[model samples]
Target: MANFIKIIFFLIIVGGIGIYFLSQSPKIFQGSPQEKVSAPSQTFVSPAPTSYTSPSLSPAPQAISDYLIPSGFSRGQLSPYFEKINISASYAYSHFNPSEIKLSSNLSDNEKVNITGWQIKTNNGEIIIPQAINVYEPSGLFPQQDIVLSGNNYVNIYLSVNPINKNFRLNNCIGYLQNDYVFSPSLPQNCPTPSRSEISYLSGQCQSYILSLWGCKVPDKDSDSFYVSIGGSSEEEVECRAFLDTIDQNGCFRKHRFDSDFLSNEWRLWIREHILDSQHDRVLLFDKQGLLVDEYTY
Candidate 1:
């Protein structure tokens, strides 16, 4: 029994020594003084983009006044002024012979519009037009800027679209001008030609070789196919309006529909010259005042 008691005392003393030693030793699994616990790595994420907008896609500017201005007055300090106007986009149809577009407009309702100007917009966003403009009257090309009039009615105006662009696209628009003063035909009449850097696409003769660089063809002045887009009753028309409607929606020109006699060297040459550049998808039009008028995207 005495030996057993001695053994127990010995075990108790040894245990205390072991415990003290353990307390002084550095920890490994639970982080020692020199060791550190590594945290999980963090990931990075970018913020989403804000609203998308294009400066080039902004809408064109409009004239300030709704009424006709007197002749001799400048448009907001410019030589030729465009008055309040509206485009008859629906009734716009193609015209041939001289290669022009016959567009009807409601201009100077309270006053007759004698003088006018225009520009052409191509599918590639670049205007294929010259700076020179020729105002026309019922008699033909009017050289003098003279007018005798009563206003408030629809007038038919002509714009040359004979040569389609490389992309087979074109838009011609007449600008409506206005200013402040007693406007009258008696007021010294003259529409001086504006000087331009590039050749105006609108100045060329349809079949003449001098204007051949423009790649023009005789247009189908008789066809009313594009009318469906503006509310023409296709059901009552000669050609099926539904089929015509398809072509209009797609904006494609069918050779058969344009004119039955389209297979000519002139037509072929025009097509070859005015080949559309895929890189240029937008065409823009500006008035004499250097303001945006119209744009076409193909």
Candidate 2:
């Protein structure tokens, strides 16, 4: 009986040991193969950039009305013989063409006359002459000399002496004398002629051979018109006319329409031939008929 009990106990101990070994084996050998971690997948994309710009500006509008004087009369300096005259435009635009004034008096040679008052009438019947005492007289004449009317006015009857020659002869007088009592024509506003010295200087320095090649002369009939030429070729003639029109008193010409060569040549020629160095610059004095009465190139 005792042997039987001991055998049973031994078998029980052996079974317990086998069960512990089985549990421990599973814990030590059951782990799967180790796996390596991979970095997150990435995509490269370029970013869009913004652009900047500045605002644009607009130009202002120009004015429309233009002031223009009548065709004749030395716009300003209308003598003070007229009364109650009103100019068509403001005095600013009073560029009168001297030829337009008409004289109504027949005078003996060297006769003295007295001018009382005068008036200025516009083409539209507008009178601009102001009411004033005698404002003009021959340099040597008395204070009460003949009435000198300027602008577009019909001169009243009056007797006056021949300021220049002092010849006592009756003449149809329409204009006033400068320093002397001769009825010479009036000159344009600015004289365009060049003195001899000016011509010499310009000829020596200017680059345009054509400019140095040309000649200049005063106009016979009209004080405002002048002649310029390089031996009278058709091209040269055309160029001369174009140059005169450019420097005309009216200032009406398109600079861009002319060629660069033509402008340069004309400018060089004008500088060489027309600019005066002396005290007396060439000037145009007009008569009542807008004719070149006298020219002084001092």
Cα lDDT of model 1 by residue, 209-283, tens digit: 222212212222255333323244433333323322322211222212244432111100011122233344433
Models 1 onward score TM values of 0.21, 0.18
Off by over 4 Å in 1: 1-83, 86-103, 112-117, 124-285, 294-298
What C-alpha lDDT do the candidate models reach, one value each?
A: 0.30, 0.29
* lDDT (Cα, tens digit) per residue for candidate 2, span 1-298: 9999999999999999998899898565656365345689999988888754211100101121113222243334222211112211111111221112223322223322222223223222312212222322223342433333332323321111122423111111111132122232221122233345533433232214324322222222233322423325565455544444433212211222232321110000000011222233333233233322222233
Q: Candidate 2's error at 151, in angstroms?
A: 18
